[model samples]
Target chain A: MSPADRFARLPDLLAADSDLQRRGRWVTVDCRVDVGDQPFFLALENGALAAFERGTRLMRSSAFTVGATDEAWTQHWQPVPAPGWHDLFALTKRGVASMEGDFRPLLQNLQFFKDLLALPRRLPERI
Target chain B: MAPVLDPMIGRYLRLQIDGVDHRVYFEEAGRGIPLVCLHTAGADGRQYRHLLADPAVTSRFRVLAFDMPWHGKSTPPDGWEKSEYRLTTASYTAAIRAFCKAMELDKPVVMGCSIGGRIVLNLAIAHAAEFRALIALEAADFQQPWYDTAWLHRPDVHGGEACAALVSGLIAPQSPPVSRHETLWMYMQGGPGVFKGDLYFYRVDGDLREKVKSIDTKVCPLYLLTGEYDFSCTSEDTLRTAAQIPGVEVQIMKHVGHFPMSEHPAKFREYILPILEKIS
Candidate 1:
């Protein structure tokens, strides 16, 4: 499946998972994730994914953007990534990923994003 | 380049501390009074790579940096994989004591940053006469809350990455790009669960508020330095802690952060030289 399709599935997966829903509750933030060339925006409110959209033009309300190479994203979405590709911070630290704009929200809800991003790794191969 | 001095050497020593054998990895350079440097939590001796290379430091003092067990090149003892490795004050001090004894370092001037910084207080309090002095960077009574560790223990949450982000946030906003990236890279390479295990000591087991009053500066002079942007242990935190310990000297490192030695070695060295001069 294309990265966009996989990203689009995140909202539903987040909603269905009770743990993420509860943990993300009261966390409202607009974030952008750039996988390879494909850029996606996620609007999260009250612990639920409010919106998931594709493209680079960010919502004026977006707080931060997390971008990584396609290869890095591919490795990250694997069931078990190698040393450098396992975490978003790891990618940023290794220069494989970049995070821009306001970082407060990103750090304030680090685990939420950490769990949210790992969702795609659990999807079936056909998805 | 100027004339090349002696090159740094990397070696391992087998030592039994607290009844467990550990293969400790360490780097050494120069010859003179021993200056033992300790790296931050989850990081190894490589943080002092530049310090080891600096002739100003090496010419006067024999500098050595060792990787704590389960960190950097140091291997964990038997059965470590099955159980979580937590760094309590007792375990940390024991390793340092054993390391010093094995190296035959007579009252070495020990310096450490972050968890390395926090443990030096314990070293001074328990074994004051063992070291000539103590230099602590980003040392505090306790670290403030930054990231939640519950997710770090989860299977989906990669500890190394989570730790990198947590540490990156504490770095000074004005740190140079190359230095910042280099410092971050160190966190990325940490062993699994090492960061979290070390925090247990930094945050919980290493609380020195009640214990700091017992430190005798005359026996082992305590020097505290905190970076301007280190939110984990702010300058204010170090100052407040320093106020309690009589004769303890404190300084605020401008435009630096948690990892002073690694983040900006040249800048950090400038601050350190004055201190070393006073001691020498």
Candidate 2:
């Protein structure tokens, strides 16, 4: 499928996924420029592990990840995958900016982060 | 290891006190009435590096500094013992008494930073006759028995690497570098059980303000100080605390936070030294 088609279809896929649910508002993307053969971006809220790697491919490491509480999050010292994930997440969730990132990884691991976006929907089923 | 004494300081000592028998780590420089300085939580006595370096500070008095037990080179208490105060506070107060007797100090002026400050407050309340004067930096009153029960059961606020990372961010300049050992030491010195115990008992007890009013000390010049961003106490709260103690003096170090001694040394000395000279 074309990159545009994948981008356009993600919302529907999230809505349809049994194992996912949309949380907060729009999802965030991190595009790692350097690190290894593939660079991945992660999304987070309150410094909890969200999802990442829109431009690269890697197998699912875990089905779901948790985030730290607001206090713990404030104490988190590790740098995030991308530079602007926090601010961008805030802006995009508030409808201030469009979701934007490079296209290479989205074409590679399109399914996972999209599933991540669909995470909120699956919560009732999981519980 | 002999601490790498900063040339800024003159003579240093490693002595063992009689009552406690625990190592008392101290450094002395310049001369006048002696000022005994205690470090804040999660730090050694050496934190006074900048305070000792100031020309103005050295001119007025002899500064003697020591690390609390389980901090710096001092050893931890061998066994648990109940007292009027919590474990950490008790050892520190005992150490102060022992330090005084060993040195034959005649009510030497005393100053403490953060938890160290809290210890001095407790000392003044219990042994008011021993200190010529007292000053505390961001010291919270734990004697009134205030505590947060909810937090007592939770994991150490600094439980793991994430917590250590957070601390590194707070004291990055003081922290040498990132390593598991350093992180673990931070958590240990910021004692897992005792740290929470002190906080829980002190926060919920609710009578610390009143207790401060009754301390029968020499009206021994008492000064309460904190930085602009102190997490433990706000300027408003610390000032209110000072007001509760009849003769307590108060000062706020600007452009710094909880660890004012490390973050704003020159200002820390600027405020504390003169008080030592006056008392000495």
DockQ of every predicted complex? 0.05, 0.04
Model 2 Cα lDDT, one tens digit per residue, A1-127: 3222223333444546444343323324343321112233444432233444445456533223222222222212112211111221222222333333443333223333433432332232212
Interface RMSD of 2: 14.5
What is candidate 1's TM-score against the reference?
Answer: 0.71
- What TM-score goes with each of the models? 0.71, 0.56
Query: CA lDDT, every prediction?
Result: 0.82, 0.50
Error of 1 at A21 (Å): 26
Candidate 1 lDDT tens digits, B76-108: 998997999889999999998899999999889
lDDT of 2 at B155: 43
Please provide TM-scores computed only on chain A for all of the candidate models, following their numbering. 0.90, 0.25
| lDDT score for candidate 2 against the true structure | 0.50
Best by DockQ: 1
Pick out the ten consecutive residues of candidate 1 chain A with the lowest summed lDDT.
Answer: A80-89
Candidate 2 residue runs with Cα over 4 Å from true position: A1-127, B1-5, B8-20, B77-88, B142-207, B216-218, B273-280
Q: Best TM-score goes to which candidate?
A: 1
For candidate 1, what is the DockQ-based docking class? incorrect
